[model samples]
Target: MGEAIHNVIIGNGSAGNGAAITLRERDPDCRITIITMGSLPFYNRYDLPRVFRGCYDWREILVHPLSYYDDHSITLRRNSRVTDVDARSRTITFAHNEVMHYDRLLVCAGGQGYLPEELSDYRGLMSGFGSFEAAMTTYKALPAGGTLVMLGGDMIGLDLARTLIDTGYRVVLLTNEYTFWPHRIAEDERDGFIQALGHMGIEVVDGVHPVAVEEGEAGKPARRVIFDDGGDVQGDVVMPSYGLVPTAEFMLGSGVDIERGLLVDPMLHTTDKNIWAAGDVCQIWSAEDNAYRFYYGWNNVRLMGEMAARNVTGANEAFEGLEDERLRIDKKGHIASPFWEH
Candidate 1:
């Protein structure tokens, strides 16, 4: 007889979609809405590399067709960027100046590739691999048998390099302090990983710190990544892989605690009673350890979303992080990691 409960989710990635689906199933009569900045529906980011193989079909990379959301009675609002989150008012203000209210809210906005202030001058020239559009852009920029100069190394970038090399493209990864993200490579493990990458035909240049990007000479079409030491590497495309910084700037001034990321309890509930956060946008507090930690990787993120949804629907489920964090090199000098298999 009363108004139906309205549930809103920010973001349309793996964690947000996972939560939306579970929320609808648990509360069939409630109104479910998803707000995302992306133009497309849920797609596998890991599958973005398939585009390099000449598979330009976007549908092949989609995790769920657009109709899947319609069938589940979930409203998907694409291209709608949230400008602010007023926790006390329980409202979200969009970039278009539209404000909407919600009964329960979930934040799974995730993170984005960050170029530190020192590299700010080269932001415009840097290509990306974080989304479908980025992948397409990189694909279009690269010529046949072209080279990609990766400014820094990360798991996803390394994975992309592996795919690029298999397709007869060259990749030169510039070593930096933030090379391997989410996994801190020990001194003992570094040689093996670098050697494995070499075995894969990926050129690993060590101790090079890039400071700027510049256009090539009059006859050359390549871009140059200028090092701090005046040396440089030329490539068809340059991508910065310094890892992701949590996309939680909009949550600022909302009274929700944020340190590196949104602070949430083990149940994914923020300090605000009506809101919950999951995925890369949040740091979970560990009572036993007395520290807040971030759990990266797809398996952990997907589980976080499902658990957050259940907790939102009157269930008490604590997220126990997944165990896909190990990285190792095989006898054949091949790098193996559960993180890249995604």
Candidate 2:
């Protein structure tokens, strides 16, 4: 009976895809457009490690086939990177200099691998375990039985290590932390994991910080990694697994509140009333912590996207965050925690 609402969502990962579907379900007549920097539509990033290990093909990891977008009547734009956002004018400019107006905007651009200064100049020599393209590039460059120096003890690092080992590559895991998952697992559990990795022929070095990367010959990847303790290791491939940083560069001057991520309320609305944020790119208000914190993992991100969509469509659902019962599977295929609370 009234003018149709135009909803523009950034990113085509789980959060962006979930929000698009939920928005369409809630408001059938509304126009929906999903702009993504990636070339594919809505693929599962969690399967990237599997892609590297040769367990699954890149096409198999796709969450939804292209037909799904057509069936739902959602306009999906690939390779359209958002360059800037004008909150006041309710418009977004892409990397190609194309601009579009939107009635409501949802920023779910997710995150990228955090590259440390030591590895910054050697980006070409380093591979990221965070994205599909990065994983593929690293996998292609790896030679059979070649040594892989993994820098970081994060979940992605562990996953990459497992994949490389299973794929017949020698893996040396370097971590600045005292133990694997020092913050999450018990000391005994950490020790057990270290033993497990050793049994699998993977070397684990703890409390070792990387100082610099010694570049290799022309057309070759970094050959050596130097640590702060004056120790070093040579490898055919270097993979950085230092956590993820929010991909919020476009929101810099958009009048949106961004700390570690785009700050959002319990309802997933940003500082700007018409704009919302969800997934890894958003730091939602946590009642338990009395501050804004990241709610990670696939289940949490999907739920956040749905809730954000509901709020955007005037459903105004109060998000309580992910339930503890939800199972968290790390990149290594291990159930990280609380698969079933007793």
Best by TM-score: 1
Clashing pairs in 2: none
Best candidate according to lDDT: 1
Candidate 1 lDDT for residue 275? 93
Off by over 4 Å in 1: none
Candidate 2: clashing residue pairs, number: 0
For candidate 2, write residues 110-189 as lDDT tens digits.
98878877668877767666667777877777787888888875665665676777777889888655224313555455
Q: What is the C-alpha lDDT of each candidate?
A: 0.88, 0.79
Counted clashes in each candidate structure: 0, 0
Residue 311, model 2: lDDT of 91
| lDDT of each residue in 1-342, candidate 1, tens digit only | 998898999988889988999998899999989999999888888778899998797888889877898899999999999999998899999998999999999999999987879989878888999989889999999999999998777887888888999999999999776677778788888887888889989899998888899887776756998988999999989999988888999999888989989999999999999999999899999876789988877777878888899999999978887765778887777887677766
